[model samples]
Target chain A: MEALFFEKLKEILEITDRELSANDKFKEYSEWDSLANLSVIAMIDEEFGVVIDNSEFKNIQTLGELMAEIKKRTK
Target chain B: MLLSTHHNISIKGLAVAVPSGRISVDSFYPSFGEDIVQKFSEMAGVKQITRSIDQQTASDLGYIAAKKLIIEKNIDTNEIGVLVFVSQKPDYRSPATAFVLQHRLGLGKEVICLDINLACSGFVYGLQTTLSLLKNSSKKKALLITADTSNKTLSPEDRTMIMLFGDSGSAVLLEKEDQGNAVFQFGLRSNGYKFKSIITPAGAFRNRDLPNKVEEWADGIKRSDYNTHMKGMDVFGFSITDVPNLIIDFLEATKTETSHYDVVALHQANIYILKQISRKVKIPFEKIPVSIDRYGNNSSNSIPLLLADHFEGKSQVLKILISGFGAGLSWACGSIAMDTKDILPIIITDDIYTQGDFKSSEHD
Candidate 1:
């Protein structure tokens, strides 16, 4: 699940896979704009059936945290 | 939510009038910069849109479409028993726009004219209302006009709204024909609690304290009570979830097979959101016609505008499923079938309100 999410995060953020660690702080990325946020939200909903609120997206800082939120909701 | 008319109310003719002023999405390059403009064009799916002139109002465009429908269909003014104008941007804040339209069109005194305030879901709601009124009544024909000059309500500097809305209007002739097909099977719902999700915060009475306060946000865009504001995520979430589910339920209630319909015309909101709904509903992408790329979101006029723009030239029998969701946080979905032979080409004009041709005037 972490690997899958890592790949999606890389694709959505337009970054190299090596740069996207599960513990990496995604909010620090310069490309973390509304489009990236919406794309991640859409990807999460489409792929995981987890509806991430915009506020939640803002609060989430790391890839691991986002995955944990998805897991928490999906479970 | 399902309502079916006992009397067959067929849409005999349909037409739309778009203002001559055109704004290409690419024109935003100087203001929004190339990257932001490109991203917005991709996100909003708006490539080009018709914009009404400063002097124009919703009534002006609606009148043009209505006049064209009346003339093209050869509809007698006296025979029209109902005139329903659906608009959120009516010309006057007090008197209903429909009454003004009735006088301008020179319809008889017996005609029942009403104005319904609605936005995105307006066409479906207006159609259902028109059909319900025509049912069991002595009236044989009704004229339904849906128009919106939503562009006028947007903040010029707001990133969220400026590029997303367009101005346009449509007129549909609904006649009770015994030979006509059953008009609509509808599902409509609203959540006023979420009304703030998409609204003009200050222009209305609720925000009378700050009716005209304009402030620049941190993003450097200036906005006031009069400008439209939207919480994109909320609107997007509601629409993508509810619209697709409502369409699925609507189809089931109407006993329609997914494969049987010819077109699934959802409101021209956003290409990404529409694609999301399409994927969720398992409907083919091609089946869902999109005009937002060309027309932006024309509010209430979207569906009829979609029809007049996309299906005007085709003569095939059209079995379509339409859903609209937006301001008022409202939604309406329905299945409708009609013959496209009566559909008229969309009229693009710069002509504003004119009593008659000056050259042909008897007084002249």
Candidate 2:
């Protein structure tokens, strides 16, 4: 599930790097923006059928964190 | 400024000549793909557009349009005193296109011929310049010609510009005849700093020797440097923010309201941007005349081309609000009053199939 989530994140955000070291921030990476955020929101809704609020985006700091949240919500 | 306060110059004649090859949005869709073309057409409000595939340069299109005007008006070529050729695309860099056109139209060597390098905001600026020249000079008749051949500059991969632009030209003959079209208040503004925001990266002195560097940016194809490059989101933001303010300033200066004008002809940039402007200014959609669907954005000629098409054979005192906005981050809008009946008939030959009839055509 974690690998699948990482693959999905890589595809959605077009992230090239496969490995992420500890303390790496997703926002600090090049792909983070309002457009990307909206895209991610759309991806979440389409993939998981989970309607995440705009406020929830503030809590997500990394791909791992977003994947965890989606897993929890889906469960 | 010493001229009489209560005087006006009218548009004596207006004519448009487009390329022989016409491509409707329906027929054009297959080249770009149905989904993208449909979205672009819907967004730009362009139903049909004309192009001159056989003609290599935009000057050819301009010459055709000029010829048509001269023939239709039955005016002697010697009568033309001033010729203003407005286009970003000229056949040569140094020699003015106006001169070429002057010779083509058989206008005498004494005629004052010049080129104004502008696009979206060109028609209004050309009009303003021509009017100023006419006011001061002894030139009795002036020809304002706006033409562009964007396809030559475009790449097949360039969906944004390819779907948006069409080759077209318009010739407006200004003479000192009684009961001519009235040129009302005009508002012109530009921000040159944003010029790089919408421009081809190569060509001319900047990238003449550095072919490799240009190839790196434009990906081969020397003509790629000729095509227009626009940052769509930035242009949209600029249009939405600046256009309304300029319109308000124009209204204030002219002492007119939105409801006062009979028809508003906007620079056919895109349907979405125009819609946003209409909403911002609270102008009814029906009040605005749209020709973008049939004719893609024709740079400086969009407004005049539309007017020439709409006013043809229609006998009525028409008060029109004309505005054009585009590259150079420029915009110009104004009002003109004229009798629509003076213009000849305009026919849409290419892409005769109406919208939504795409299913019948295999091109769809």
Candidate 3:
């Protein structure tokens, strides 16, 4: 599930050149833009069937946190 | 969430109007490269959008639509006992825009007037309010106008917004009839917590001192505080999650089935967003009437515009479900059944209230 999460993030954000790790701050990436952020949210809704709203999303700093938040919501 | 069904109300007439001026995606090729322009165009599902001219206000479009409906339907303006103007753009900050519309429409001095400041979700909100008020009042006929000139507040250089917003206004004439067509059910919710998700910081008194000087924003877009700033990601999350969930609940509460509706007219927030909502509720993509491709997202007017542009004032019974979401961090859904003839054809106008032209001499 964790591996799939990172995979979907990379695909949605269209990140190339650099690898995305669990600890990586996705916002710091050059590939990240407003569209990228929106795509990630949509990707999460499609892939995990849970929504992390804007306020909760602000506290999520890394790919690992994003995964954990989705997990928490599903549980 | 407020969920209730109102009876004895049928939309007697409907009309939507836009300015004759148009901004096509092809026109943006010079600012952004052709490749970028086309890519954005595909993403937004926008071919072109109508825009109001410098002298034309959102109210002008609303006035035109209302006037057209009255003239075409041969409505007795004296019978219109209430006027509800819902818009993010009003002629003045002082008098509610409804008063001005009332005067221009020649509605009686005793007409009830109101102005609601809201954006995208306003059509649903306005419909419910107009019907509820009319239900309790002595008069049975009322006019609901939802208009927005959101583009006027957007930064022209902001690619995120410039191509997405189109200005429009709509008028729905409602009357209580002994043999009304159908009941109107609405479910609404507001998340004031996310109010800042879409905002114009300096326009009002709180941030009155904020200058209009363009400054590099945190997102690297240069814009003044006066421009409407939208947190795209936040709103996207809300649109996908909160909006669709409420709509699903609304469907269940209203006992509306997939086959019940002839059309699912959604606020054209984003084509992808609309697709997500439809998928969640298991509504087919074909069932949704999409005007975004040609008209862009014209704020509160999306629902009426869809009816006007698609149905074109012909007589036929249709079951319609409409959902509008945005900007208050607000979302609402409503369903109604009515004859298509009441849904008048969309009109185009560049007319402005020339009497409103205010000029003050430097010496005065």
lDDT of 2 by residue, B144-226 (tens): 98988776667656666666788877788877655533555678888997888678767778777544222323322223455
- In terms of lDDT, the best-performing candidate is 3
What TM-score quantifies how close candidate 3 is to the native fold?
Answer: 0.93
lDDT of each: 0.83, 0.71, 0.86
True contacts kept of each: 0.14, 0.00, 0.86
lDDT of 2 by residue, A22-60 (tens): 345776777664335544564565567554554566777
Per-residue accuracy of model 1 over B175-262 as CA lDDT, tens digit each: 8877744656788888898888888776656777784767885445788878888787788778778788888887787677778789
Task: Output the number of the DockQ-best candidate.
Answer: 3
Candidate 3 clash pair list = none
DockQ of model 3, rounded to 2 decimals: 0.64
Chain B, candidate 2: TM-score: 0.86
lDDT of 3 by residue, A1-75 (tens): 887887788777666666778888888887776777777787888888887787788788988888889999998
* C-alpha lDDT of candidate 3 relative to the true structure: 0.86
Sorted on TM-score, best first, the list reads 3, 1, 2
User: Which numbered prediction scores highest in TM-score against the true structure?
Assistant: 3
DockQ of each two-chain model: 0.45, 0.04, 0.64
Q: Between prediction 1 and prediction 3, which has the larger TM-score?
A: 3
